[model samples]
Target chain A: MSLSVRKIVISGILGAISILLGVTRLGFIPVPTPAGHATIMHIPVILGGVLEGPVVGLITGAIFGLFSFLQPGAPFFADPLVSVLPRLFIGIVAYLIYVSTKNINNILALVLAGAFGSATNTALVLGMVTLRGYLPFEVSLSIGILHGVPELIVAAILTVILVKGIQRIRTSEDRPPVS
Target chain B: MELTRNITLGVYLPGETAIHRLDPRTKIIAATMLITLLLFIKSYEAYGFFLIFTAGIIVFAGIPLSYALCGLKPMLPVLLLMWIFQFFLYSTPDANILFSWWIFTATDAGLHMGNIITLRVLFLFTVTTILTLTTSIVNLTDGLESLLKPLRKIGLPSQELVMTMIIALRFVLILAEELDKIIKAQMARGVAFDRGSFIQKTRKLFPVFLPLFINAFKRAEELIVAMEARSYSGGKGRTKMKTLHMGRVDLGAGLIMLLFTILMIYIIISAAPQI
Candidate 1:
């Protein structure tokens, strides 16, 4: 397969995963917070960055953002700035993090990339929401702490495990058997 | 775990009504116009007209009202919560107090805000749902691609983007089925997914998602290879198997939409804005 087609297909798959996560409500883990659910929707965007490149991540994140905007559960996410722009950064930042530390430790790199990606989503979304006067700064901060921290932790763990597993599969598939 | 069954977003129901026969672009443009009008709509009178218009379309499109509204069932809690928040939080200086409880106060203006916003959301959902219901996915794609073709001059890969969106939408159901299988497999292995506390349930999801994602990547890789083997290149120099045409029905639909737009504008101008 050509490289561009491969990237498009991979990104499309990741975007599909992101949308399916929201549509099926499987990605939303209910928590006792104002938002009621902590989402793993951004994880696929992070994974797209780690597996493919920043471009794929950006497209996947944009797709995820579009879905959230169309099917916004909260009023804040109905705005494209709050829903879409933050997500556009997820893949770029995650890819940068992964590349910087990839040689030293792949697993740690994945975890950090995942955490940073999730943190990017939380910080930018809430920051935009507060900036737009959707919610008070203190209220946004409290909700961020309540929902964002756990989401970051989950993203870190999942990103590490999934990247490791996929890497193993790719490497093994690339290897040839002894004669 | 039958989450896939509840999804009605992309599922197309075939019909032979004139509404269904209207050009996809016409439906798309009309829905957009209605949604734009919905945003500026304030008074109950406007919403009353909006409801009648939507109901007429629903009937004309041959879509069952219940089926059209089934998607809203899942969103009721969120909508209700939003209504409650607006009822207690939204008010103006001249508003009369309806009730007061501790730190929260409900006002007459708050009630109107709550009602208007909730109705707006409901109308928005209905409009989109109607568009999707009346237009099939293939037509929807073609219409969107044609509409967005103007951006190609700016170096935007509009066709490729639309292709990606179509593929992603197709996979929503496929992945949901995959999730169901993974969840069932985990259950077979004695993971009581339904019996756990919220955190415990969420933690259990890691195992399911890990496998699902791994398999998804594998599927994507295979799909890429399959497309490459078929010599499939995106968007560039692609010819349509069926080109879209605007028939007489589209012109009629366009005229009706224009009339609705004018009426909505009149109401928006004359009606008092809700505080």
Candidate 2:
């Protein structure tokens, strides 16, 4: 009962930060493609999911998606469903990957989770925006493909760092438990 | 840590206002309905009424005007970019140019487009923010799950999704608090976080995040064990401790939303099309 109360408090704080970072722009680098903008700020989200589990991760992704949908510049021009549903998918997919994996390195699980979560976010949001017919299909695909490469790479690296680092902490706490 | 400071959604500010006391499901649907109406708001007059109506809600909810608008700080840049894009790309063939520079030209139509679009995004954020600010996280989850339950027939797994959402919403503040602590702990050392080049500052973030990541994973593993101990399973057979109800508040809120949507639709037809 006490832990559940503590978890709720903790969860609220993480959700708030995710929304804040997800909304603020750190200056986007306009790419050659219509929606090309490069920013590496999604690191918190990747960490948020892997650390808090898929539930936290999904919420982070959903919040990011919601923020994007609220943007007037959104290619699909910002529908609420477009903003939210993809994020929801990102969260579920990442967690699903983590839960389904065999007992191996935690780093590997985190990597897959981050990669899948982020990729789902990018794919679903971009697909919905494209459906709005603001830009041509080929153009949107090119943009998605181009930006996806870096997003995936960063997600993979972040997963390893966060997952391994978190595992180390758990083991350290356990070390003193039996003593 | 600092990032979560701007978050106001699903916060449940603990108030005595009428909106605050409304059922969580009612507020959720009211917010959704109002936002949908907002999306179709095309006229200055309609938006004027909306602005007034939104302001009324803010006051009624006991939220300070400044407190509400302050949340837009982080979103300002994106709004500006949207406005800029509208300025350059939205001109019609016969639209009069308001300003002209190198290649980018700002037209009257484009200017209107910018205003309407920006106004829409701003209001959308505000409405949702207010909703979360009043409703508790658990109630919000229950409401969302109840609302989404119909999607189960379509293979939506709405219950599980809502559970994930509830946990996510809860974490927003926790991570922020944790982040602040970790950052301060680092600053206690010789780490000069604020006194370095942009790249250097960013690079120094590695140590801060290193600890945060480790703590987060530990929490997740702990959560997993705790769940197993409780014999927890997925959304299949799970039952709710609290059931949803549609009180008078929902009916009142629903009527208000219907009236607002009707008025907005009428104005949308009468107003000049910005697009």
Candidate 3:
């Protein structure tokens, strides 16, 4: 597709939002204190996937990962690969999930798809991270489960809303207007 | 927990020192050797020698002592928990009970186990951090890609893996910046994120992550089309502008490692085992 003002605007908006949610240290729910909460911080990223598909999703993942790396507190040995694989997986999984389902069952299916995408993301990341010997086997395994459940729940709810919202807009655009 | 921030474990601090300029391949290989040595080190004296050796590298790499130690912030709680668990759970036949509390007993063996294990982790992170801090990401990627290039013959897709790695590395910074912006946007909307109970604060997170994940997918799709438009293909034919080679500095580093290894081995053989 040719370059458009909409693409630029959406990217700038999403980038701005992503940078905001990622750096604030705002969501420090006691349960997962250090890593902070999952929240809707990933929305710009998911939207990136939905709009541009998986490749853009992967690029967005890279952007998100880089954002984490450059934080003042960024760890030196921080592996960008940990961030890339998971987000890339999310993009691919989300794209596939969106395309595969014929009937848009409102928001439920979309939410499930988002959850599965998030789960795919968590598994790949934690898997590589554990391999690198940074995290102990047990903690890494525990994280996979703990982080996975919340991401699923959060992703599911928001994805459903987003999918439906987008669908509505698309339908409105497809409508034939009368004079 | 993948504590994405805790990844500095293997960073090499770049410096003007001799070790910093060694071929990435040599450093990578040497680091592997050092890590392997660490696993075999079972005695306090052995670790002491390892400590001195690593300290030398830290000094050479120009990493501040406190700064190097700070990478453990995220892992501190888990390490402490690990120590606590081992203290209460691990026991041996000759273990002496040092303290007793409500259904919990601390033993000499357990204490030794915790101390030694914790030290191991500390040194482990330290060693790796020094490596990464010293080596630039581009160099690291080039080094790693070249090292893995041989595996390409066996169908490894080395270039793609390296490309993937570099992108991931870039993300650690990009996403943080993104998160920062998103938080501000929500804050502008009067979301008092910091003013709630644990559960309430968590609930507030819905707005934050909803946007983050959605944007992430959007970026990925755009990136893909951008790459395809450039006619990019998988790692079949890629060339390098700079090639890696081990020089005299690496030899010096090897000598240092050899001496350190021998001293460590002797300490392990003679010193009492923490176990």
Tell me the whole-model lDDT of each prediction, alpha carbons only: 0.84, 0.65, 0.61
Error of 3 at A96 (Å): 12
RMSD of each: 2.6, 5.7, 8.0
- Model 1 residue B56 lDDT? 96
The DockQ values of the predictions, listed in order, are 0.49, 0.24, 0.10
Across A111-147, the per-residue lDDT of candidate 2 in tens digits comes to 8877876687678766975675333466557767887
Give the best candidate by DockQ. 1
- Angstrom error of the Cα, residue B226, model 2: value is 3.1
Give one digit per residue, the lDDT tens place, for model 1 in A50-75. Answer: 98999899999999998777666665
Tens digits of lDDT, candidate 3, B1-275: 12234335334455787766888887877776776676567677777777788888788777787777766675565567666756765556789999989967788877776676677667666666666777888888888888887877876555665565554444545555555677778888899876777657767877766555455545645665676777656455666688777788888888877777777767766664444
Error of 3 at B131 (Å): 1.8
List clashing residue pairs in candidate 1: none
Q: Which is the winner by DockQ between candidate 1 and candidate 3? A: 1
Considering lDDT, where higher is better, how would the candidates rank from best to worst?
Answer: 1, 2, 3
C-alpha positional error of residue A115 in candidate 1 after TM-score superposition, expressed in Å: 1.6
lDDT-best of 1 and 2: 1
Candidate 3 chain A: worst-modelled 10 consecutive residues by lDDT: A69-78
Best by TM-score: 1
Better of 2 and 3 by DockQ: 2
DockQ of 3: 0.10
Instruction: For residues B1-72, write the lDDT of model 2, one tens digit per residue.
Output: 355566565466888877877787888777877878877777889989898888888888898777777667
Instruction: List, residue by residue over A1-179, the lDDT tens digit for candidate 3.
Output: 22232333344445444444443433223455444344444555665566556655655555555444333122211345554445556666776776676376635557656777777767777787667544556766776677667766766766666666555655665688863
